[model samples]
Target: MGVPRAFPHLKMRQRPVNISNFKGSTIALDVMGYVVKGHYRMMKTSGLADDNTLPDSTPGVISSVEDIVRTIVAAGCVVYLVADGKKLPKKAKEHAARAKKRENDLVMAESCFQLGLKKEAKKYLARSTVISPATVDSLKGIAAKFPGKCFYFGALFEADSQLGYLAQNNLCDLVISHDSDMLLFGCPKVLFTMNTKGWGFYYEAVDIPTALGWKKYSYEKFLKMMILAKCDYVKNIAGIGIARAQKIIESSPDLSITSILKTVTTLFPDSGIPDDYATEFDEAYFTYLYSAIVDPMKMESTRISPPPLDLTEEYLSFAGYVHSREQTLDIVLGNIYLDSGRPSRNVTDPSNLDELFPPECFFNSMYEHKKEVLEFDVDGWEGPSPNEDDDEDDERPKKFDCVECDKTFDCLSRLLYQTVTHTNLKAFSCHLCKRTFGYRQTLELHMRIHGGVRKSKCDICGLTFTRQDILTNHMAAHNEARPFQCDQCPKTFKTNSCLHQHKEVHLQVRRYQCENCDLSFKRIRELESHKSTVHYKARPFKCDKCEKDFTRKDYLEQHCLAIHTSERPFVCEICNKTFNDSAGLRKHAAVHSEAKPFRCDICPNMTYKRSDHLTRHMKDTHPAKLEEFMAKKKKAKRPPATSTEEPKKKKPLESTSKANIKIHKLSPQLAKLVGQSMMSQIDIVNKINDIVEEKQLYDPNNHLYAFGDQDLVNVLGVLRFKIANVFNLLNRHLE
Candidate 1:
C-alpha cells in the first residue's frame, strides 16, 4: 500500500523577546496586500464606494504594507527584497473571467499605480536578487540588503489551528488575534494585543506572563471531541454546538471517529448518506493540519503589501511632482531611488558638484591625477590587433539568457519586465486555485485557500470571502444601508439617487405642459429637458444640415440625407413590386408572403386583385399558353436604337478601388449645419452684459435703432458681419 500521509506537529518556541532585542530586524513582505489594494482601487468607481453620505469603505487592506515599511524603517531595521520566480505563461483565453468582473474606469488606474510603484521600488532597492521555491538559491534581496540582520518574513506563522495545537504543546508566544476558536484549537499564550505603537506594546512585552496561558490538549481526545460534536469538517450535524459536542465526547473516549461514524450509520440506517463522506472529512481535517505544519511558497517574494489605511490618513501634500522636471530621465530614476530608500547625493548636497573651473583646467586636473601614477591609457588606444584577425574571425555580439523572456537578449531589466510582466505573461500559478499570477506572492495568496486563512471575510451573511471590502459592499444590500435620499422622488439609494429620481419624472403621468408648444411631459425634469442636455455628446454629433447640433449621429445623418438618400433596399420579387422606401417594400413583400391580402367586397371578387383580373381575362379570351404567345406576337418588341448601343453591365470595382472610394457624400449645406459651434450660445450673455458701447445702429438718446432705407441696408450688412465674426471667433476659441 502507498504510504498514507501523516500531518506533522509544527510548533515554535515562544521566547516573548523584547522589541529591542530584534532592533536590526529585516522583514520580507509579500505583495498580496498591495495587489489587493490595487485591485480595490481599480474597482472603486464601479458602484463599490458610491455615496457621499457614508465614509469611503473600500478594500485597501493590502496597501497596509507601506505603513509596515515606514514603521519598520523608523524602528531602524534594514529591509530586503526577494522576488519570487515568475509564473509560467498561461493559455490565451478569449473569455478572461477577471477581465469581465473588472470595470473600465478602474483597470487603467490599477495599471498606473502598479507600474509606478514597481518602477519606484527598483530605483533604490539596495540589493536585488531572485529566488525560486524549487531552486535552492541562498541569495535573498532582503537578506542581501543587510547581511547580518535577523531575517523574518511577515507571514512567518500563519493562522493554522494545528499550529495552535502545536503552540500549546510548545508554550509558544501568544496568538495575536481575538478569535475564540484558538482556545478550542489548543493555542497557549493567546495575546489579544500587539498594536503598532506606544507604551501598551512595551508593557505587553515586559509583562508577558499576564497575557500568557498554559498548554491544555490531548490530541487524540481533541480530535474525538471534534468528531462527536459533528464539528469535524466531514459531518453535517444540523443542531450541534460546542457544549453538546463536549458532553458526547466526554461520555465516550478512545472511540475511533471512523468507528463512531459507522455506529451512527448502523443505528440510523435511513439517514441520508454523505457524498464522499469519508473522503470529504479526511481531506478537510488533514488539509487544515498540513497547512499549519507547512510553509507555502510564493512567487516574487520581494513585493510588500499595500498600506491598509484610510486615504485621509495617508494623504500627501506634494503627491505628484516627478512629471514636471528639467530632466525626465533623471527624475524617473530619482523617484525610483527615493521610493527604494535612497536619497540622491546631488539633491542632498549641491556643493559636491564643486566650483566651476575652465574646461581645460578640469581636463588638466584629471590628466594630472592620472599622470601622478606615471601610467597612461595610450598603450590600449590601438584597435584590434592584426594577430587577432589571424587567430580567429568573430565580431558578433555575445548573447545572454533572460529569465523573464526565456530568450537570449541584452541585459536590459526594463525591457525584460515589460515583455514579461506588462504583457500577458503568467510568471506564477497557484497550485491550489490554478490562478496565474505575475509573481509568486500573488500566487501565495491564492494558495491560502488550501491553508484556510480567510483574513477578509463577509460579516453580514457570515460567508467567508477573499477580499474584505467586497464584503462591505455586499452587506450594503442587506438593510436600509442607503442613507442618501433623492430630492425629486421618495426613492432612496446609495449613490446617484438625485439624478435617477429626476429621470423618473419622464415616466410619471404627464403633469407639466409646455405653454408655448403642444408638447407636454409628466414631470418638469423631462419637460425642461432640451436636446442640448446631452451636452458633450451633442457637440460630437455635428449635423450635416444648417449649422446645428444633435445628440446622436443617426439623427444627424437622417437630417443630412433625408431628401437625397431616401432609396429603398428591400423589394418584392413578384409583380415587379417596388417602393421608394423600406416601409412600402415591407408591405408589398407581405402580399407575396401571404399570397393575397386584398379582400373582395363583391361575389368571389375577393380573390387577389391580380389573380381576379387574370381569371376574368382567361374566361373572356383564349387562356392557353399558345394564346399568350399569340398576344405577345401581336405586340412589337423593338430593340434599343439610341446610340445604337447595348446597355453595358456595370462591373464591381476592385477591392482596392472600393476601399479608396468615399461611401457618403456631404453637401455644402450639410457642412454648414455642423460648423456652428456649441460654445456660440455660451458667451453671448456674458458678451452682451460686458458692453454698453454705442453702435451706429443704436441711438444713444432714443435707446433704439430707427433706420432710413439706406440705414436699413447698412444695418443688414452689419448683422451679416456680426454673425460671420461670431462664427470666426467661435472657431478660434474652440481650436
Candidate 2:
C-alpha cells in the first residue's frame, strides 16, 4: 500500500482536470487501484447481497474497468492498462500480515451479517475484498474491445513503477492512478482519482514549488519525505508524520540521504529509528528510481533508469528479479500467470487470441513481426516463433561501443559524446552564465537565453519565448480556453488544477450541521465561526473606538463603518443611493430595475428580477406548496449535512494559559513594543485602543482609514505615525 492518506494530503493542491484535456495523449492507467476501488464502490452501492452474504464484485469490477478504459479511448487517448505482476520481496511480510488481517475481517463480517449488523458487516466486508491477479486478468477482455487503441502490460513488480517508468521515459504523456507515490517515483505528470466521465485531479512535478509553497524543492527531497513517512518498502520512525517529515527535510542544511538521516536522529533520538533505516531508505529510493520496467520498444525487461556503478547486486534485487527476454515478452503479452511463474492455461486457446487480439492489435508501431498471427507451442505455451533464433539478430552492427558503460552507438561521434557523460571533461562553456556543457550544440542552445533569441511568438498577445514548447504552453493562457468546468457549478477554469479548490467552497455548503441546534453552515469556516460566536461566545475582533467585541473582523469593520463613520463607499450607479457594503449597494440597485427575470413556477404571471422575491411570492400566494418548494430549494442549495456536536469548552484559565503560551508567536516588533511599555499589559492594550480611537483609523472618512495600504511607502508612513504616538504615550506613562 502507498503511504496512508498520501493521496488526500496531496489532493489539496490538485488541479481539477477534464478527461478530454488529455486528448491525443498516451496515458498509463494503474489498473489495480481502480480494480480495487471499483470492487468497493459496487459492493457499497449495489448491495448485491442485501441479505447476510458478501457480494462477488468481480463482474462489477470488470464492468467498472471496462467503462473507464472505453471512456478514455473514446476521448482519443491511447490507453496502456498497467497491471501488477508480483510483489517485491521486501513487501512479503507486510503482504502476509495484511492477508491474515483480511481473513479475520471476513470472518467477523460474516458473523456480524448473521447478527443483522449490516452497516458494521459492510465495513468489515470492504476490508476483506480480495483483488487478486485473476481480477486483473478479467480486465484483458475489456482491453480487447479497443484493441488497437488500448494495450495491456503486466509489470515485473509494481504497476506504479511501470507507469512511472513509462511517463519518465516519454513512452506515456501522463500516468493516471489513485496512488500519490507515483509522484515520488518522479513521474512528470500524474492524474489521480480518475472517473469514467474523464474528470480527475491532475498534478505536474514542475508545480511542486507552487503546490508546497516552497521557494525550491527537488525530487530527491520529495522521495525522502515519502520514505520517512513510510512507503511500501520502508518502515517509518514512530511519531513522524508526512508534515513532520517535510519540516525535517526543509530544516536540513543538506538534503542528501545521509545528512537528513543524521538530522532525524538528532531530532528524534528516542523514536526508535531502525538501525538499517538508511539501507531501507536507499532500497525504497532506488526502487522508485530504477525499478524494472518492460521496454515497449525493445520488448524486454530493463531498469527504469540506469543503475549506479557502485550499486550492489542485492540492492538491484529491490528493483525486480531479472527475467529472460522471452519471459518478459510473454508477461507483456498476458500469456503467463502473474501470481505464479507458469503459463496461463486459458491463454493457450488460439480462438481467444484470434478474437481478442486482431492482427493489427498490440503496439503495431513498435514491433516488426515476421508473421501475421501469434504462434502457440504444442506444450500449450504462447510466445515468439520457435524457428526464430537470437543468432539471426547478431548480424546487426555493434560498433562504436562505450567501454565505460557498454552502450553501443551507431556513430563514433555519438560514442564520443556518450563517453563525456562518464567524465568531468566539458570543452564547451556558456560565456554569460559560465555553465559548462559537454557539447558545442548544447552551449549554443544555452546562449539563446542570454541573447534573447526567441523564434516562437504568440499571435494573440504577441509574447515571445525561447522555445516553441514554452510558446505553446503560454498560448493556453491567451487561447480563451476554459475546458475545466465544475460539475456542481457553472464556473469554468482555464486549467483543471484549480477546479477542485474552487469547488470545495461550494461543495461543502451547509454540509456541517450543528447537533445541538438546527443551524448549519455552508463551509467548515462558517461552522467554525458559528462555534466561536454562538457556542463559545468568543469575540476575537474588538472595536477599538467603542470597546465592543465582535466574533468576526468584517462585523467589527461594519460596526465602525455604520456607527462611527459617515463614509458610504459603495454607491448605486442607477440611483444616488449609498450603502456601507457592496452587498447593500447591489440589493439597492435591484429595486431601480423594472425587469422581472425570475418567474414563479406556481404562478407564471408572478415574476421578479430577484430570485428571493419570487420565493417570497410563492410563500405568500401558495402557502401549502411553499413548504414543498422551499424544501426542494434548500435541498438543491445544500448537500446532506453531517451532524457535528458542539466541542467541549475549556476553562477560562486553561484557555488564557494556552493563549499566554502562544504569546511568543506575536511579531517581534509588536512584542518589543509590549516589552518597552511602562504600563501593565492590560493598561497597554487599553492605551493602544485609545490611540487607535484618537487616530480615527477605523473611520472610513479619514485619509489614513484605508482597508489596506497599496504600497510600501503608505504602509511605512501609517506604521511610523502609530509607533511614534504609542512611544510617546509609553514615555508619558513612565514619567
Model 2, 380-477: lDDT tens digits are: 22333212311222433456566678688785447556756776456665543345677656775676665556766788888877765577667768
- State residue 494's C-alpha deviation in candidate 1, in Å: 45
Query: What's the lDDT for candidate 2?
Result: 0.66
Worst 10 residues of 1 by lDDT: 1-10
Error of 1 at 621 (Å): 46
Q: Give candidate 2's error at residue 225 in angstroms.
A: 1.4
| Model 2 alpha-carbon drift over 4 Å, by segment | 8-13, 46-52, 107-111, 256-258, 345-362, 365-735
lDDT of 2 at 19: 58
Steric clashes per prediction: 31, 5
RMSD of 2: 27.8
The CA lDDT of each predicted structure is 0.34, 0.66
Give the top-scoring candidate (TM-score).
2
Error (Å) of candidate 2 at residue 685 is 80
